[model samples]
Every structure is written in C-alpha cells, then in structure tokens.
Target: MVNRFKDPSAHLEIADLFAEHDRSSLPIELGVSRRTLFRYRDLYVHLIETDEELMPNLNAARQDPHFQKINERLGHLLDRYDSKWTEMEDSRAEAFYDWVPEHRR
Candidate 1:
C-alpha cells in the first residue's frame, strides 16, 4: 500500500495517531479497538528490535511463511486505517533525522 497524502509530514502524524492506542485523552475513532492497536504495536516493536534483517527487507519477509501472518495483519490494519507500512518506515527515518545533531541533519 502507498500513502496517498499530499503533505510529507502527514505520514508521521497518521502513524502516531494510528499507533496511539489508549494513551490519548482526545481519541480518534478508528476501525480497530485500542487493544488491537496496542497488540499490533507491541508485535511491531518486538519484530523490529529482534529482526535486524527483516526491517531492511520486508518485501522478502512478506513472502516467507513465517512472516506472512504479520504481513497479512499489517496489511489488514493498513487497509482499515488507510496507511502503508512504508509510510510508517518513512516516518521513522524522519524522526531519526530530528533526533540526530543539527549538523548531522
């Protein structure tokens, strides 16, 4: 899936809002419950932290039976929320750019 938003920053905002789960006082209504969001978030964190190779090669991982379930779940959520995993990844890179020293950026 591809992010259709015109503004580049919208990617990060969408990712943040979609991943917010139950943390926000002002909640956004989405297709999935907060519990589902939290569960998927935890899974995403664990997957990225533990699988270094997978992060750089999600397309390949998506084809493997071991990772197919995650890919399907992510695709389902992305479809429901109108997002792409690549957009979430782009948001991570954007955040990293902000985290580094000003000179580095």
Candidate 2:
C-alpha cells in the first residue's frame, strides 16, 4: 500500500522498508507472517542538543513581559548596529557588496 499522490522512488527509505515487509509478509505475495515496519526515528537529537543558549532564545520568543522588554532592548541594539553598518560596510565594501546581493535575494 502506497499513497496515490506520492512517488515511491523519491521516498526510497520508506519505500524500501515497505517493499521488504510486503515481500516477506503479504499473504498473496509471500504467504507468511509480516514483520512490522519502522522509521529510523532518532528522537534524541533535539533532546540531546538542548543547551543554555536554546533556553534564552526560546524565553525571548515566549514574550513574557520581562522577556519581552529584554527582547525589545535586543531589537533596539540590533537596529543601532544596523545604523552603524554603513561604516562597517565601507570597511568591507567589496565583500559586503558581493555577500549582501545574494542574501537580499
């Protein structure tokens, strides 16, 4: 069983697993007990990567009044840096011109 809309070859990992199980388990195909298919779900990656910085970024976005005030101050500081960017841009004019054209797109 595959979804009508999705390409099986494009989803090679999932398609291969289903095909392996179907060949071994389908009553009409193999006439035997079917093994359950599973995804290689490494759920620990996000849990493992959580750190001191993640909490601060999330806390800022959560927008509690105190955090929101800090977020506003950070935004103001960023705007100040942006305002002073012309001098920095002049210092790195060639690199900045080349880099920013790609980024702005």
Candidate 3:
C-alpha cells in the first residue's frame, strides 16, 4: 500500500515502511543494504525537516515495538562509517577549507 504523503522519493522505500497498514517487512527484513538504508534514513531526516506532515509517521516509527532493535541495527551500521570519518579527520590536521573571506583577510 502506498503511503499518503506527498514526497514521491520517499513514498516507497521510507514512507511505505512507516505507514500504518502497509504490511511490508522492516528494512532489514527486506534485505536493504546498509548504505542504502542509511540513504533512506538521510532522506527521511530531510523530509522530516522540510515536510511537517511526515512528523506523525516518524513518531509512529519511533514508537513501534521494534524501534529499539531497528535503532541498534542502524547504529551498528553507522559505527563503521563514523569510525572511518574520525580516523580520516585525525589523519589530517589541515583545514578542509582554508580561504579567508575578504573582510577577515
């Protein structure tokens, strides 16, 4: 079942999974790759910021009985990327962008 939200990009992957009656399995159950799932979560976060209508659905997702399990799984997946990002940043002391603005200069 299609969720009734207006964002087409999230309609299938994110929204439908969060819908009240869609009956689709959780993202992990669907064999969604970790990177793809992260992309979906990022898209969902953007939608939550820009589209207030999604808030209710997001809240529902948060309150789901499986929320804790899902959260743990996502967190575990993110830990690898987080560790890599930290390591990369620590490896370089150079500022990523070092241009001084005209006024500051």
Per-model TM values vs. the true structure: 0.28, 0.21, 0.27
Tens digits of per-residue lDDT for model 2, 1-105: 111112223334444434543453222322223333222222101111222333344434344444444434433322221234432122221223324467777
Clashes of each: 0, 0, 0
Per-residue lDDT of model 3, residues 4-97, tens digit only: 2224354344433344222445433333232212243323221112223333444456656676554444343233322344322232223266
Q: After superposition, how far is residue 45 of candidate 2 from its true place, in Å?
A: 24
Question: Which 10 consecutive positions of candidate 2 have the poorest summed lDDT?
Answer: 42-51
Output candidate 1 Cα RMSD.
12.9
TM-score of candidate 2 against the unseen true structure = 0.21
Q: Which regions in candidate 3 have their CA more than 4 angstroms from the true location?
A: 1-52, 79-105
Q: Kindly provide the TM-score of model 3 when superposed on the true structure, using C-alpha atoms.
A: 0.27
Which residue runs of candidate 2 sit more than 4 Å off their true CA positions? Answer: 1-61, 79-105
Query: Comparing candidate 1 with candidate 2, which one achieves the higher TM-score?
Result: 1
Tell me the lDDT of model 2 at 82. Answer: 29
Q: After aligning candidate 3 to the native by TM-score, how far in Å is the CA of 60 from where it should be?
A: 2.6
lDDT string for model 1 (2-54, tens) is 22333333444445544542254222221212322122331222112221332
Q: State which candidate has the highest TM-score.
A: 1
